[model samples]
Target: MEDDGRGFSFTVGSSELVDVGRDSGVWDVFVQAEENAPLARIGRLLDDVADRKEIFVYPSITLGATDVRPYYTVDNDLSLEVARQN
Candidate 1:
């Protein structure tokens, strides 16, 4: 993860990362899985945007007109993770 004077940018493998600007007050991520098993949650992505606290939620991925992928959020406490790597 890297913050380039704007927002955060995560390097998901070797692909070029998309920068999420802090001024936009939005953080978007893609939840991918090959199987039907559910994706695990670790924590909430919260940021103070324009003096207002907000929890960042995952929105739908829009790459093209016919390439929109919807995603869902799962709630989980990081405190409950015993020696688990996030």
Candidate 2:
């Protein structure tokens, strides 16, 4: 991951060290929600770095909080997804 004073960016990889290309899965990225706030999709990652060879964009901004940050999640991450969605 990297921050260029304009935004946050990063690549996606398998935590299991397996191939993420064959499946062509995408990771749903977001900005971490704070109290009384909502989660928002910033961008997504398609497959792994080798598979897509693309740079995902995540524009950074102040969420009026002191510790807000970016978040990356796979499909159906209910713990975070549900709370934010509801």
Candidate 3:
């Protein structure tokens, strides 16, 4: 949820959908989740990219990759979680 100072924060939820972030014209802005944990849309990422944004809608419908590992962990944890925590 940290802003990279790029004006728009990474949006995993739609401004009109999940009810996260503030409407900032072209894009919505979000802050880093206060208490990020597994199984939540924390600011975890892959290849220096956040993958959660695509999960706002069903991965299949939004053209997001569906990985059983992230949502369904052996410990029932997220494969991608807060980068700082990782």
Candidate 4:
């Protein structure tokens, strides 16, 4: 993810799950939000990298869920999925 403070950019590469075609590479993107963010954020981000569009960005999100772990004390698990942008 690349950001210029006022705006940000994401680059998608090949050899990813979203690869739409060969010669796939980084695309372009735009984002805007008010008090609420759009759900397309996930798709856009995932698709961008996988489909060779661009990096997708959504407003920061806060999720809430019950803790079911018995011995695990970790509160959150963050994971990143990498796919081809093409």
Best by TM-score: 2
Question: Estimated TM-score per prediction?
Answer: 0.19, 0.23, 0.18, 0.18
Q: What tens digits encode model 3's per-residue C-alpha lDDT throughout 1-86?
A: 88777454453532242232322112222355446833333233444434434443322121122121123233222432211110
Provide the overall lDDT of each model, using Cα atoms, as 2-decimal numbers. 0.31, 0.35, 0.31, 0.29
lDDT of 4 at 79: 26
- Model 4: runs farther than 4 Å from truth? 1-4, 18-86
Best by lDDT: 2
Q: Write the per-residue lDDT of candidate 4 for residues 1-86, one digit (tens) a residue.
A: 77657555556432242343433223222234545765222222222234322222223221121111111112111223222322
Cα-based lDDT at residue 17, candidate 3: 29
Per-residue lDDT of 1-86 in model 1, one digit per residue for the tens?
77577444354431121222211222234443437867644344464333212233334343222122222234322211011111
Off by over 4 Å in 3: 1-11, 14-59, 64-70, 80-86
Model 4 score (lDDT): 0.29
Which 10 consecutive positions of candidate 2 have the poorest summed lDDT? 77-86
lDDT of 3: 0.31
Model 2 segments more than 4 A misplaced = 1-22, 43-86
Candidate 2 per-residue C-alpha lDDT over 1-86 given as tens digits, one digit per residue, 9 for 90 to 100: 57667655566432321232232223345565457688866634434543221232233333222212233433312111111111
